[model samples]
Target: MLAPPLAAGELERPLVGQSEAVILSLCTRGNRLPHLMCCISIDEIDSLAPRRDEDSSEGKVAKISVLLSVLEGIKDVPNLMFFSATNRLHMMDEAFLRRMSGKFFVGRPSSEARKRILDKARNALNPKILKKLVVATTNFSGAALR
Candidate 1:
């Protein structure tokens, strides 16, 4: 929906079916997309841009093309950034990966990392118990520990 434009009276109604035009305008035209952070999560990498063999819908392919173009276009624009987090890296399509300028892997914490994590939370536990807990939490995330 065109919530932003509709509120500002740019358009009388939402541009329901003009996705490509809208995306292109947002990327290439004026300061329609503000200079800010855009963090997103696509849980199923395969679903968005599945392997060509696994995808048959023309709409999906078209969507992939449009999305890639928009992302690739505005990547160098100052003060604009997109942060996407996905756990299913292996399932991501090659085109999606190719569009990414940098890729970082955040795996489970190592022993030193775990120790540092525990050091901040050692007030409630004995030293021996903290050591045991750190070892036992070998694969837990920072959020899980918190």
Candidate 2:
């Protein structure tokens, strides 16, 4: 259900041609790399493969085609796995969603969880400030707290 996060620059916009190669390499690197296995986590996946519609451009269509082909090619790979996260799942391509093995939704942290996150900075913040921060960060994500 999880894979290693990728470097920031790898997932930049205009994912048209570049993503296909990145996906292929990550899935096929098992043979060349010492681990004989590889995994990737593509954040904001919707930007990479949005649903095709009447307004879709040629480059967009081509990108989706290549992405689907790459994914299909790796379906039988035993040592490769990929996971992705997106806040806007509805904007993603249906074909792309169909390829996912499972889906999970993670909500914002609870009060205690928020306090725990603030505890990490306890050395820098006094007890009064930490308490205020927990309340201020209500409904915040773990990443936001960090």
Q: Estimate, for each residue in 1-146, the C-alpha lDDT of model 1 and write its tens digit.
A: 22121111221124433544544454443244555543333334455555555546665565556657667754334333434556667767678788777888899888778877888866677888888988899899886776
The candidate maximizing lDDT is 2
- Model 1 regions lying over 4 Å from their true place: 1-30, 33-47, 73-79, 116-123
> Which ranges of candidate 2 are over 4 A from the true structure?
1-4, 7-19, 31-35, 73-76, 122-124
How does model 1 score by TM-score?
Answer: 0.59
Against the hidden reference, what TM-scores do the models get? 0.59, 0.73
Candidate 2 residue lDDT tens string, 1-146: 34468643464446556755565556566556646556667787787789999999876776566667656653345565667788998999999889788889999999889888879856688888888898999988898899
The candidate that wins on TM-score is 2
State residue 139's C-alpha deviation in candidate 2, in Å.
0.9
Q: Deviation in angstroms for 114 in model 1?
A: 2.2
